[model samples]
Target: MAASSLFAALDKDGDGKVSASELRGCMAAALGEEEAAAIVAAADADGDGLLDRDEFLRLAREADQEADEDGRWRCLRVAFAMYADATAVEGEGAGQHITPASLQRMLSRLGSQEPGLDECRAMICRFDLDGDGVLSFDEFRVMMHDGLM
Candidate 1:
C-alpha cells in the first residue's frame, strides 16, 4: 500500500502479505471488494491469490510512473506558457515558444546553473530547427526530447 490508499488498520497480521479480507478492508471504499480482488488477482503474479509486498510495490511503482508522466506534461505545458508569454513581452519571435532571453530568465529564476545570455543563445541555436533564431512549440518539443528542458 505504499502508493495506495490502504488503511493501517487493514493489515491485521502485519506480515506484509495482503489477504483477500485485508484487501477488501484496505481498498473497499476506493475500489470495492470485487475490484480489489480483481486487482489482487492481476498483480499477485505468483498465482497465490495473495498480494505480496514486492508485487504490491511493483504495482505502486507502475502507477506512480503513470501519474508522473501525466503530471510532467501538464507541468511542461504550464512552464512553456509562462516562458512563451515572457518571450512575447520582449518582442522576440512570435511568442509561440521560448526565446533565448526568456529561457535564460527562466533558468535564472530556477536558480540552477544560470547560463549567460551567450550560452542561452548557443542553446537556442542548437535547438532552433527553422533557423529563425527562435523556438516554436515543435522546436521546443525537440529540445526537450534532447533533455534540454
Candidate 2:
C-alpha cells in the first residue's frame, strides 16, 4: 500500500510511468521547487529524465524493509488507497478514514514475531500522520504525494 501510494505519486502523469516532470512535480508538490529538484536529482538513477516505476518502488521497499509486517501492510494499504484517491481526483485533497477490512487485514498480516511487532509499532508511530493508532489514507497520500518526510 505504501509502496503503491509512493509509486503512484512518483508516477505523476497517472499514465503509470514516472516522467522527469512528474517526479519533479510530485517533489515540488510535496516539498518545494528547490528541495524537489534536489530530490529528483538524487532519485533519478539514470538521470535520463525521471525515475522509472521499478526504481522508485525499489527505494520505497528498501525504506520499509525494517518496518513490521503489520505496520508495513498498513502503510502499504493506506498508501495504495490514498494514491488511488489522489490520482482519482485532481490538485490538493484532504484525508479520509481507512476501511475496517483494511485494518483487519493489516493486523492479520502481523506475523508471530514479537520483535517484528515491536519494531513495526515503533515505525508506525514515527510515520503515522493521523495518530489514530494507525496510518490514515490522507496521511499516506501526503507522505507520498509531497515526499515530505
Candidate 3:
C-alpha cells in the first residue's frame, strides 16, 4: 500500500493524526520501539508526539528516498544475515547470495507455510538483475527498496 493509505490505516482513532503508540503498533514487526520513537521525534515538527498527514507524508517520502540510496544496503545486510542463518552451507559459500532454494526456505520459515519452488524461482527472476537465477546483495537491495519483494 502507499504510505498515505498506511498512515490512514494506522490512524485508528480517526483524529487525522498518528500518535507514537499507533505507529509503534503498526511498525513494531519491522521496527523496534526505540527506532519508532526516534522516527516520531524526528518527524513530529510541532513536538506533539504525533504525526499529522503532512508530517507523516514527509517522513515517508524521505524514508523512501533514503531507501533508494544507502538505506537499502542496510536492509540488505539485515536480510542477508537472516537468510544466512537459515540456509548457510558448511562450505558452499551459500551466504554470498540468495539461491532460489534458499529463498524458498527463508520464506517457509517466515510463515509462508509451503511456498512452491516455481513461486520462489519467479520471485528470484523478478529481482535477479544479473539474470544468474539468484539474488545478489545488490539485487536484493533493489528488490526491497523498490517494493518488488
Candidate 4:
C-alpha cells in the first residue's frame, strides 16, 4: 500500500500525525507498548512522541526494506504466474512446464523488441534442474529471484 494511505490508516483522526495510541490500535498484535513507544521514539525526529508524514514514510520505507526477501518472493511468484498463464491451453490451466517456445511466446505477447528463442532456451537451460529441456515452477522461481526475469 502507498505510504500516504497507510499513514492515513494509522493516523485515525486525520491529524496528519500518528500517535502511540493510533499506532498501538492499528498494530496491536504486532507489538507491545514498549516496542511501540520505542518505534515512535526512533522515528519521531521532532521528539513530539508522534510520527508525521515524513517520519511515517521513512518508517514505511525502512519496513519495506526489512521485508525485502518476502517482497522478492511475491514479485517472483506474480511474474512466474504471468509467464505461466500466458501460454495456458484450453481447459489445461496455467503453470505447465515452461519451454523456450512458451517463454518466447510470452515475451512476444508482452511486446518484447525481439523475443529471442535461443536466449530463452539458454535461460531455461541454466535453471532447469531436472534437465528435461524445460523449466518447472521451482526453476522459474529461482531464475526470477536471480534477477534474470
The Cα local distance difference test for each model comes to: 0.75, 0.56, 0.83, 0.84
Candidate structures ordered by TM-score, highest first: 1, 4, 3, 2
TM-score of each: 0.54, 0.34, 0.47, 0.48
Question: What does candidate 4's lDDT look like per residue over 17-135, in tens digits?
Answer: 99988899899999888888999999998999999999989999989897997887787777776666446676764566787877887888889875588998887899999998888
Top of the candidates by lDDT:
4
Q: For each of the candidates, give the backbone clash count.
A: 0, 4, 0, 0
- lDDT of prediction 2: 0.56
Best by TM-score: 1
RMSD of each: 5.6, 15.9, 11.1, 6.8
At residue 41, give the lDDT of candidate 2.
Answer: 64
Tens digits of per-residue lDDT, candidate 2, 43-143, equal: 67887656667767776676567466668658767556642323223443323433333334444555433334455456446547767645565555565
Deviating ranges (above 4 Å) for candidate 4: 1-66, 85-93, 113-119
In angstroms, give how far residue 21 of model 2 lies from its true place. Answer: 4.5
Candidate 3 ranges with C-alpha deviation above 4 Å:
1-72, 84-92
Residue-level lDDT of model 1, residues 1-149, one tens digit each, is 34444523555688767777787775667877788888788888999988777787787787789999999888777767766735354654455777778888888888868998888889889988899877777777777778866
Worst 10 residues of 4 by lDDT: 85-94
For candidate 2, the C-alpha RMSD (Å) to the true structure equals 15.9
